[model samples]
Target chain A: MNTITHYSDEIINAFVDGELAAAERRELLAAAAESDRLRQRICEAVQLKELVRGAYPARSPEGLVKGRSGRRGARMRHAAAAAVAVLAVSVALLLPRPEPGQRLADGALSPVLPLSTGEEAGETTRVVFHVSSADPAAARELLDQVELVLREYAAGNRPLKVEVIANNEGLRLLQQGRSPVAERIRRLDQRYQNLLFAACGNTLERLRRETGEQIRILPQAVIVQSGVSFVARRQQEGWAYIKV
Target chain B: MKTMRPYTPFLLLLSLLLAAPLAFAGSDDGPKHKIVIQVSSDDARTQKIALNNAVNLQKALGQDNVAIEIVAYGPGLSLLTSKSRQGKRVESLAMQDITFSACGNTMKKVARKTGKEPQLLEGVRVVQAGVLRIMELQEQGYAYVRP
Candidate 1:
């Protein structure tokens, strides 16, 4: 059961779609041979592929040849056909349509206001601190460091935009009551006008689904749809990214 | 069908013109080789081996010809921390264009127990999930190496 649970639907789909490399294919096949549950999963995946193909029959290619020409023309046609085949396969396997309610709007995961935008502004040095560890002490230390850096900038009369983005195990630090540094975080939030904390919604949802625990985050933390996308967006906006 | 006969030669020429570039495009740059190295242990020796692997790979395949990314997660992330003994070494390799990514998940976990976030070395990017990053690189045809 443990082994079966480890095989995600994505992996199974990749295997069924022939996207796995030879080594991975061999490994998965070996595993499937040993576990009835895994074998069932593989069987289900194959059936789903057949069902999809059946539903989208037009997606399957038809013969393109009409009449024979010269050797060079034949070679060119073959190359073109092969290219088309590759394109079709990639489009089919790589581009999975998003399910309803699964798609997020652009910047939906970002804080309502950019962390760098505040009253005292000359030139804003935007920085995003990423936290993914579950250790409460480490989370507090990270916040401490963030404050140290911010205070240094403040001494120089510089405006700073700071965001602490937490995902996965790091989300624990944002949990209310459970977080060891909750008091420190609240105090820091009150003191820093330009600092923000974001918790990953994806992780929260996963925790709820897996453990049936309704985790409540600190009042200071904003929920972002996905932490990675938020970080990527910040990076693209030219913010300095730091992992703490 | 008889009327379409005259258009066959033109269609063949058009297909050849289109396909020729597509075929030659692949040869112009040759194959791009990529590798993702995973570091999930805190052992200094293991960290050294990962670094050695990167250095050796870069030497074997000219740096510009190969893309290499080292992903550190869990306790192995110590290798990229500013306080780590190997911090200087990590920075040196990063200068050679070897990407170093630290897992944010691990950082938070460590922060929870320690009440502090481990300061990462300069130029090391923090990703939401280290394993996911490796999976992405692998999906993009990068070879996975766990040295």
Candidate 2:
């Protein structure tokens, strides 16, 4: 599942750095097409590379940001997903099994050091929560844990950067019309930008297609590429990862 | 599917050190991506999802750009069986350079129960243990996905 979901941060950073070959770049793009997480990793990679290059604020690439609007993301979304699925099944060829422990990312495999956080804006501890289950109990459990974490950080007088990324079945937690816990989410969202609620774009597209509903998200919920990628990025940046 | 830690105070249990973020694992050569998929269910739907994930990965990343592996165990051992519904697809995928690993432990169990070793499809590889294959792949930086 990691292969289908996770891409090492190195590959993404390298791609964003334009240090990868065309063949590898296309593969990454194609893989990111069907994966919500891979796309998010790509987004993080782009942001980090740009930040390093002092080129932030440039427009994000297209397709990577689909499903921003309700009407805009409908119908066509399914076709695109179907096409990608079909493409996924159709491609085939022969290759040798890679030796175990041999990474496929960069040849150097050097660890890219993170920028010093002491100089970061605040005494903040970033925590990214991954919510993928559709079960109501699971959603409630996540919120409960989140509240506790929020309180703990509050006690420490340390700012916390928290992102609750909802994807797959767990997306129900953030849906304006579908979430069973809308009130709680609103209360938390209103707390401040520190606690973010992100709706997975791919999950939204799927929901829109399956139900033929605009399926509005909570007002404060931000749209992200995918939950797995969001969590992966946060983990890469040394943020805490919580699977709820 | 049951709770692993229903009431475990996740934060208290894992008071993470926010000192330094993890170091990157980027290499400049070979296939740029490696993924290992786990198929541990006997359900037809789940088995197909796992296969689709593998083939889609192959298509998206191209055969040469990514190394793919599918490891089966427990009930999922059905996936690598010669008589399995996915036999044709598995054989075709194996020829495409995708590695399909059957659990030797499961094979021994099945053989003990049925009094004969189950035949795996052509090109499939048998590992000493299925879960261990996944663990090793993960340790090697192969992305792990359980579908």
Candidate 3:
């Protein structure tokens, strides 16, 4: 008896779906004949297929004949087709399977550098503040919230890392000369080395394109390609996200 | 009629077989734990932290077990913008099953200011308002997180 030790679940799935090449199918069948495990796997796949099909039984000839009684027949056929489509979708969703790889906006996945290290490696407390409103009052309020939280952490001498990301209208806060909190930001920057300010490149580009003028950001602010992307990557890293 | 009685058991067995898959498909393990993270800042560090939270939660709960939605609006919407620095990472995590929702209101605001619609990343879904979206998700039993 030949022992098939190398077959992958993907291959078995394809075989069950009748998607395997002729040569592969023959090889799998031969191996199945020798291996109880392989045979059982095939049997289970077959049963699953049968069960799925049975859940949405095909319309019988007698039903079709009866539907031919009038315009209702065509409607019934359409309804049946719709029902089958829905059932197919439900089965697809319920199946345990890996999702297809998603294509990036740039049409390819670019290599990403490891972001967490040194100071960022498993710190006790990490927080991120989101400031997207252009209103000066709103921006200051958010800044206040950050200060309030940081002060609490500071009193405890707890190791903390805080980030403030400004994009869209929130970019108003990071502007070099126009920001109402420019002096306050400069003071904060001088005071806290752990806090970082990030500005959105897309917003700058949009501003330049619209007004035909370059917008200057605060000297302390670091320009990032996309604010949303930055936040998303940070979230994946387990950082706390706060919208202000 | 008497002759058809013997076949009844066989028919019942066949029906049971057919019903099994439907039952399995329709069954819900329990109430799903969901989270909606709000990203309102355009800052890279803030965005990174938000992304990190999502990735960590998925790792802890298993991607199939937990549902996470990151809602971006105002300046934070830039995170979902096409040219974002983290575009590649966003797309990669999205494939891992994270939902990125961009604010339609922010898009309109940006368009008005920039004279062009902000280009969003491929997998990002657009909703009316980021705050409203978060509220709706919360109403639907999702825990709200702002990162």
Candidate 4:
């Protein structure tokens, strides 16, 4: 039976959040199958869930999982945790493991890039800034915009998370001693849990090989496998992507 | 600028049917996902990549399964203008239901600079403020990307 009419947006969002019971999930899926409107709503809910998850990157949903055996909230939390677990497992399994030579980001980290955890716990405004231009003026402008955006969020009392993914010529902005805005970056790093600086490993390796110079990244930046892939993953995960 | 050639839906469905595990529905079932892309650069290379990103996304998601709006502001507004090197591509994508938005604020700035408003390519919508439009789209649950 189509119980589509019974499912409200709240219920749908809860479902997307993995807060639904097995029977409820089945019911919702069945309903969604028949109604394009329901399917669309589910997709939107999925987007919101991913956005919220951006506030808690790589952090397991166990905090939301403990109590489903009794209270409804508990059950919802349990379901959410289970859903996230399944997703994580599937993601890990589905993603191909690259060879050692294939790694373009960090030689120091695990072969599989470990996504850093974000500590924020609230509705998050997520943006992934992609920087590929090497222009110092552009770098300066990018930092200016980054600072302006963070301040705007603070001014509005909204929690924001920004990931600056750099590669190619833009990687210079994160290079130690070579960066034009090193001091500003250091200061920004001190000021916000809001900003994440992701340096591309591939670019570093290439630069090292081509130039034979040690390319040290600023202390505040983390080297991801590839800046481009990091941005792609962020976009796929529902982060608003901005090219700077 | 180019006009749309009539599409044969049956052939498309037949092709999709061959690729089925339903990565996308076999017919024009409307978009399940909405994306808002920003292009704020005047660099021809960057502008070209933005359009390419939009087109690639459509190809991957199935043209009818993802709604895309490419919003250009500041120097990026040049991509939607008559003078754009990619003007023909913009018009072609416009026919694919991918929206092209030019910032009205940028239009005024161009007018003040050149003593005339920048003319837009066909089917491009002008929004009052590009940044604000992007914020609005994000609020409305559209995934935002800039390539």
True contacts kept of 2: 0.00
For model 3 the local lDDT of residue B21 reads 91
| Worst window of 10 by summed lDDT in candidate 3 chain B | B131-140
Query: Ten consecutive residues with minimal summed lDDT in candidate 1 chain A?
Result: A64-73
Task: Please give the distance, in angstroms, between residue B58's alpha carbon in candidate 1 and its true position after superposition.
Answer: 6.2
* Descending-lDDT candidate ranking: 4, 1, 3, 2
lDDT (CA) per prediction: 0.68, 0.65, 0.67, 0.70
Candidate 4 lDDT by residue in tens digits, B1-147: 375445767778778888885565634455788899999889999999999999999999998789999999877988999999999999999998899999887798789999999999999999876765775687667887876
True-vs-predicted CA distance for residue A98, candidate 4, Å: 48
- List model 1 lDDT by residue over B21-134, tens digit each: 998787676337888898876889989999999999999999888889999987788999987778888998999989999988779978998999989998899997675466
What's chain A's TM-score in each predicted model?
Answer: 0.51, 0.51, 0.51, 0.54
For all predicted structures, in order, the TM-scores are: 0.40, 0.36, 0.37, 0.50
Local accuracy of candidate 2 as per-residue lDDT tens digits, A56-101: 1222222222212211211244787656544433331122333212
**Pick by DockQ: which candidate is best?**
4
TM-score preference between candidates 1 and 2, better one = 1
Query: Lowest lDDT 10-mer window, candidate 2 chain A?
Result: A65-74
After superposition, candidate 4 runs with Cα above 4 Å error: A1-122, B1-30, B44-66, B81-98, B103-147
